[model samples]
Target: MASTGERDGTGGTDGAETAAGTAAAPAERKASWRLVGPGIVVAATGVGAGDLVATLVAGSRFGYTLLWAAVVGCLVKIALAEATGRWHLATGRTIFDGWRSLGAWTTAYFAVYVTVWGFVYGAAAMSSSALPLVALFPGALGLKTWAILCGLAGLAFVWFNRYAVVEKIMMVFVGVMFVVVLYVAVRVTPHLGDAVTGLLPVLPDGSLLYTLGLVGGVGGTITMAAYGYWVNAKGWTDSGWMRMMRLDNRVAYLTTGVFVVAMLIVGAELLHAAGTAIGSGDQGLLDLGRILEERFGAVTAKLFLIGFLAASFSSLVGVWHGVSLLFADFVERTRAARAQGTGGEPPVLEVARGQRERSWPFRGYLLWLTFPPMGLLWLDQPFGLVIAYGVLGAFFMPFLAGTLLWLLNSGRTPRQWRNGPLSNVMLAAAGLLFVVLCVQQVRELPW
Candidate 1:
């Protein structure tokens, strides 16, 4: 594949540097399609079942009124992902290492967040992924059994495979789910005027919170922090790949934007037009499938359910793998005495030690995500645990945005590859929005 600067014609400073750096490298002249990997897979995996349900709920409730918020969500994610990939490409450091540079506070925050978040998120993700499957194949394996099985399966997949293999699997599911969901939207034949109107920025009555939620939600999640890991895993080290990393980030989120817009179209045209109400949980999706069957046909409903399962399952795999790596990085860093003492560990520590190469934390977290969560699938998730999860989860996006802006623009990165004016502005806007959402979440929490 050609470097991003050559393809896009945007020869920024970083682009020129990358071009110069790769000047001596062999030019294989491979097709661009062959270069598709981690970025697209990560983007697809990041938009899990919750994102889809949230978008559908927004559409069902507000029609296309919040379409701009969804678009904003996509743009914010692009900025975040680009920063992450750029950090890895420019500094040859993962996000975990980048965070450590800011201060011990960042590492401390992540240590606590990843442990608790992983526990609660494991059960939630498994249960959500299992819902559509259970609906389609009731009593085949029981809900909890299926959830545990799904988690284990994901663990196994990520444990044995390298980045390229994982990317291929994710891409297949992305293709399947995208086609299925987009086809459903096309079948709805939505209103062009209302969708166009949604593209404009307007806040309707009693929709302040919902609008904010849509803007902040869309495809935002902890996996946004995992982009650096994906970039590293794709062999995109050094400043030479910075331009490609940015392009990868942009393309990933652009695809995500289209996927989300299509879903909003379905919600606006199908459920909103009929005045139908979806339920409050994953089962609500099954309810949607039934509605689709009644209105359109059984095939349509089955296809939709299949797409839902694919989305949820792909996210299950992603969280099981991506978050586990984050957890491993956190553990390895925090346990290092130098890291604890200095308020930041050396990036060379991560590169040289390669603790993840032979670490139990990596596999242990994977097992934790697969097996322990099954109990929660059987029993109710504790309210206290849920509250903690909510609070910590709410803080991650803002934390990520804030740190990216601080690090990328600071002396830690090469000045030539640091955040330009546009990137800084976008990151600032994302940080502000996420801060507002975090505050709203904290205030509304049941303390």
Candidate 2:
């Protein structure tokens, strides 16, 4: 039986009950803030070292002119994340289960993508997380040694912890990251007038590509597809949680917007004002740290380095936990399909009771993300693997958007939960935007 509070006018509950429940809307919205874990985890996980570097680079080149693009990026991601969460709560099914319903091809694509993407990403994420630590303690160990230690630490942490524990840890890291980044933003003193003006759309000369990148890349990744799993992990497993999930989704992007805006301010005031260029990749953050030390002092620089580590390590553990949960679901569904011999269509498996955190498939992917990637720390990343990673990454957002457009508007979803006109427009825009961005990324890749 659906609760009166959850059934809106459009939902197919008793009309009298929905009319009577309208008065409680205010209280439910007010209480939604307390149920905000999955969004924070998703936002924190999405804004890793790469996002910081990209925003910094944008600030370095264009100052506040591209601020609107970052804001747009957050809005776009909010739509994606909201759609993902809505699916889980509305349908009472995992994302993998939805993908399986699409076809075996979806499963095949994910199988290849996750395996390759994780292998390469594991090494990159470990390396990114290691940079700040290596910078902070130069006398302690080599970068590779630090990277291995970081990977193993994340593995052990996620291996032993459940979703509640993981969410709490991620929140602590997000808090540290928020404060440090906000301090840097204030310390540099952004130009209020120009930043406000940036809210209006204006693409500066020679900034078209960077503007598009900022718009498309502020806070997005494969981790977004894992969002529904995180929501499930948090035990929000029914349509009754739909409104709460949407509120949580809004908070997630709002938090992400704040983080990116702060970074843009730091970039505009610190890097642009000084006319300094930082190197690309995670090392770019290190370059910025050195610049901060020169401009301020060692203590300030160390604080920034600590924040960088927080950002990187949060992403590290997030994937270790969130993606591991996704892989665990995939494994469980695959086994269930085999056991029932249900060709490609498996029964919908409820996520509320799975021991996902301790499952072997979960541990196996965690090990895959930890151990094998360490080898890439010593050896050059194979050219083929790098290309594959780039290609797969390019298509992911559009894939997500296109699929959501199909799933959310169809009979697969309940009529009340179907995509409205506004959602349809947003999903369409996201799909087209990402498709264009995907072409640019592929064209720019050194093939």
Pick the lDDT winner: 2
Error of 2 at 166 (Å): 0.5
Candidate 2 similarity to native, TM-score: 0.92
TM-score per model over all chains: 0.89, 0.92
Tens digits of per-residue lDDT for model 1 on 1-447?
Answer: 222110111122222243333334333222254575667877887888777877888888889999999888888888888888877666555677667656668878987898888888889888888788887887787887778777878888978875667778888888888899889999999888989999999888878887887777867888888877776766665566666676777777888888888888888888888898888767777888998899899999999999999889988887776777677777665566444463542223433222353468988888887777777876788899889888999999999999899877776666666899999999999999999999999898888
For residue 129, what is the lDDT in candidate 2?
A: 93
Tell how far residue 25 is off in model 2, in angstroms: 16
| Full-model lDDT, candidate 2 | 0.82
Off by over 4 Å in 2: 1-30, 342-354
Angstrom error of the Cα, residue 171, model 1: value is 0.2
The alpha-carbon lDDT assigned to residue 295 of candidate 1 equals 83
Q: For model 2, which pairs clash?
A: none
Compute the lDDT of residue 135 as modeled in candidate 2: 96
* Candidate 1: C-alpha lDDT: 0.77
Q: What is candidate 2's lDDT per residue for 220-279, written digit by digit as tens?
A: 888898898888777666666778888888898888898989988888889898888899
Model 1 worst lDDT run, 10 consecutive residues: 2-11
| Local error of candidate 2 at residue 399 (angstroms) | 0.9
